[model samples]
Target: MSLLFAPFKLREVTFRNRIVVSPMCQYSSVEGMATDWHLVHLGSRAVGGAGLVITEAAAVSPEGRISAADLGIWNEAQAERLRPITDFIKAQGAVAGIQLAHAGRKAATEAPWRGGQPLGPERGWLTLAPSAIAFAPGYECPREMTEADLDQVSVQFAEAAARACRAGFEVVEIHMAHGYLLHQFLSPLANHRRDGWGGDLEHRLRFPLRVARAVRAAFPSHLPVFVRISATDWVEGGWDLPQSIRLARALEAEGCDLIVASSGGAVPDARIPAGPGFQTPFASAMRQEAGIKTGALGLITDPAQAEQILATGLADMVVMARELLRDPYWPLRAARALGADVQWPVQYQRAKLG
Candidate 1:
């Protein structure tokens, strides 16, 4: 039996296979509302046969968006807008999920295709972070989060999780990675506060852990909650694999079901060796050391490579981003490539490969 095609269970949700569509920001929303673009983009992936399809980072607050067009789940209307998308995804035999995020210092920017620079006062809003630090040279200097801000952020995440459930998402993944709000707290390079929310690793983990606890409590008890973390900063004295393992352990205790291990984005200049499976090692370490389920991300494109990662006990799932964007039916293709018997959508069964 192909491990990549095997059913995987967490909490009460059972994926039909190990293939997951990693959340990818589309930069295609209007006032943080899901548009038809989201429906077609996410629904096609479900029809393409992914076991689970996680939506792009859905900002928890208006000012938490990475770009003007990033999706948001801060309001009931936005959550209601997503219900149809989730309904369609589930109809195609896939578990629907959403990644709740706060961009922190990285908020208020233009979309990548539109130059992706930090927006000025003409369009930008004040950003918040663990410190009054700018992400880069031309980036906005975020205001240091106060104690009240910390409590509010935690509450926002919990509210977002609850909204995700009402929107029909079966899973809610907290966006702790990619140098966003939670990651800024985790990485020393970004967070420079001397309060209980920063300083050492323990203090840095406090806010995120509290947020995790709140989100877990807000989400359904039976459904699974996942966390995506930047496993390393790739910069010395920044967040690294060892720190990630500790965080994973704490998250697991807080009822998080999986660690989607990705790396870097803490700083703009850290060198990352971008090659296939560069991040699987971090997933392996988290699973083995932290004793938690992990998903291997980053350049996981090939069927054989993905299968090897699971067969060799590296990670429980393979999270695909670019590959899935290139071919939404990648899981179906991967199933055929691995000689795993999986049902194709009846509408297209006539085109099934041998």
Candidate 2:
């Protein structure tokens, strides 16, 4: 039997397989509302046989959006629009998941296809962060946020979690990775505060842990909550594996069900040794050391490679992004490639070999 195709359970949710449709930003929303593009984009992956289909970074607040067109769950209207998309995904026998995020200094930037440049005041507003810092050259220097700001933002995340649960989502993954808002606070490279919210590892972890606790309290206990974190900043003196293990343990204490292990995005200058499954080790390490389930990500492609990951217990689940975009039916195809039986949608079952 293929471990990759085996069912996995967390909280009250049982995934049909260990394959997950990693959230990929579409940059196609209008004013934070998911349009028809989202329904089709997300629905296709569910129909394609992914066990869980997670949405792109859905900002918890308007200011948390990475781009003006990012998906949001802050308001009822925005959450309401996601109903049909989630319904379709569930109809395909896939769990509907959403990643709640805050971009911080990364906010107010154009989409990648638009060169990912910092937006002008005419298009984007001011941004906030733990400290006044810019992500890179050409990005705006964010304003240092106050304690009040932190408290309010934490509440925003909780409210977003509640909204996501109401939007027909069964899973909520907190986006704390990729040099976004939470990671900025975790990495000393971005957070240079000399206060309780930053400095040493304990201080730095304060806000993130607080947000996780609040989100857990707001979300239903029957469902699982996952935190996507950069297992390493991929830079010297930045967030590394040891720190990540500690953070993962702390998150687990805060009721996190799993950690989606990814790396880098703490800075643009870090040398990332990108290769096939370069990050799988991080997931394995986190799972063993932190004693928490982990979802392996980053450059992991191919059916055999995925099966090996699960077979060896390198990760509890594997999230795929670029590959899924290239082939929405990848999970179904992967089952065929592995000689494992997986159910295809009724309309498409005729194409599967008897």
Candidate 3:
């Protein structure tokens, strides 16, 4: 039997297979509301046979958005719009998940296709971070977060998690990766504060961990809370494997169910050795050292490669992004390649391979 097709459970949720759709921003929302585009974009992956389909990082607050068009669940109206999309995913026998995020200093930028530059004052709001730092030279300098701001952001994340549950999602992955708000605090490269929230590793972890605890508490107890973390900043003396392992352990202690191990993005210029399965080692190390379930992402395209990652105990699940975009039915194709018997949608039964 292929491990890739095996069911994996966390809390009361059971994924039909090991394949997960990594959250990729759609940059297709209006005033933080989900549209039909999100429904068709996310629902198709569930129909294509993924075990879990995670929506793109949904900003917990309006100002947390990466771009003007980024998805949001900051209010009840936005959460209601997500209900239909999650329902469709679950109907297709896939677990629905959402990634809660805050872009911090990276907020208020144009979409990637539109040059991805920072927006001017007319179109942008002040960004917030551990310190008043810019992600890159061209990016806007963020305001140093006051204690009140920290408290408010934590409440926002908790409320967002509660709303995601009401919207029918079974999993909530906190987006602490990709140089966003939580990640900004995690990496010394972006956080330069001398206060209790940023001087050392433990201090740097304070706010992110507080947010994780709040989110885990707000989400349903029977559901799983996953945190996506940049295992390393990929910059010297920045956030690295040791720090990530410690963070994973801390998250686990706070009731987080899994760590989705990804790397870099804290800084724009850090050198990352990008290739197939390049990040599995970080997941492997975290699982071994931190003693928590982990999902390996980053360039995980092939079925054999994904299977091997789990088969050898490198990670618990394989999270795919670009490859899944290229073929939403990659899981079905992988089932055939691994000789695992998987069910196809009734409408597509005739196309099922032997």
Q: Please report the TM-score between candidate 3 and the true structure.
A: 0.99
Error of 3 at 185 (Å): 0.7
lDDT by residue for model 3 over 104-181, one digit each (tens)?
A: 999999999999999967899899999898889888789999999999999999999999999999999999998999
lDDT of 1 by residue, 156-218 (tens): 999999999999999999999989999999999998999788898999999999999999999
> Candidate 2 clashing pairs?
none
What alpha-carbon RMSD in Å does predicted model 2 have with respect to the real structure?
0.9
| Candidate 1 residue 278 C-alpha distance from true site, Å | 0.3
Against the unseen true structure, what C-alpha lDDT does each candidate score? 0.94, 0.94, 0.95
List candidate 2 stretches off by more than 4 Å: none
Model 1's lDDT to the true fold?
Answer: 0.94
Question: Candidate 1 — which pairs collide?
Answer: none
* Count of clashes in candidate 3: 0
Name the runs in model 3 displaced over 4 angstroms: none
